[model samples]
Target: MSTQTSLALWAPRLLSVLRIVAALIFMAHGTQKLLGFPPGSGGGPAAMSLPWIAGVIEIVTGVLLTIGLFTRPAAFIASGTMAAAYWMAHAPRDFFPVNNGGDAAILYCFVFLYLVAAGPGPWSVDAKRR
Candidate 1:
């Protein structure tokens, strides 16, 4: 097959890889906040507080996105959460993302936004259901 055609054929699988990897990382962040999986960091957020609520959102959306169930909506919510996180929590620290330590947040925001547009791709529950 032509190189272009070969690349195109693998694109969907690559997308699935991206979705799975990103979602897993995102979920890890939530767990760190809510479950303190790695320990030694800090306690979970206070109940009903903003960080607590955000942790909830992150866990839920991360699972949905990871499984590619309700992928679009999940990604949309994830993207929004990251956007808010960057602006409210990170941006104030500095104008540049690196200085603010918001680089990861910004990356997550755009990556999830891309997933919303791209759908779950192949090997996803959404694809299976369809």
Candidate 2:
């Protein structure tokens, strides 16, 4: 096959891989916030607060995104969560992500936004169901 054809064929698979990896990483953040696993975030069965709420959203959306179920909506929600996180937690600390430690939040926001526009690709449950 031509190089262009090869890239075209592989693109969807690459998107699926990206979705899986990003969801797993995002889920880890939730685990840290809610379960205290991986030993960070000072988490422990969190109370009903901003962090707790964000953690819940993260976990739920992460799972949905990981399995490619309701991917567009999940990604859209995740993107919104990240936007809120950046504004609420990081923006107040500093103007730029690098200064405020909000790089991950910003990155996740854009990536999830991309996923929202792109859908879950061929390997997703969304694709299978269709």
Candidate 3:
């Protein structure tokens, strides 16, 4: 098969992989915030506030995205959350993502947006449900 055809065939699977990996990483952030894993990973004891709410969102949406269940909505919510996180937490610190330490948030925002557009792709629960 030609390169283009091969790429097209594998792209869906690749997207699913991306979704799974991104969700896993996002979940780690939730774990750090809510569960306080890895010891001193900030987010001291899960108070009833924005960070805690963010952690809950991350965990729930991350799981949904990872499993490819309700992928679009999960990704959309995650994207919005990341955007909010960047603007509220990082943008005030500095203008650029690199300077403000919002690089991850920016990247997550875009990636989740892409996932929202792309859907769950092959090997996802969404695909199976369809």
Best by TM-score: 1
Instruction: Please provide TM-scores, in order, for all candidate models, with all chains considered together.
Output: 0.96, 0.94, 0.94
Candidate 1 regions exceeding 4 Å error are none
Per-model CA lDDT versus the true structure: 0.93, 0.92, 0.91
In terms of lDDT, the poorest run of 10 residues in model 2 is 37-46
TM-score: the better of candidates 1 and 3: 1
Model 3 lDDT, residue 89, Cα: 97
Two-way lDDT contest, 1 vs 3, winner = 1
Model 3, 1-130: lDDT tens digits are 9999999999888999999999999988888888876455444544778989998999999899999999999999999999999999999998888999999999999999999998988878889988
Cα deviation of 103, candidate 2, in Å: 0.6
Work out candidate 2's RMSD over C-alphas: 1.2
In candidate 2, position 126 carries an lDDT of: 95
lDDT for model 3 comes to 0.91
| Residue 36, candidate 1: C-alpha displacement in angstroms | 0.8
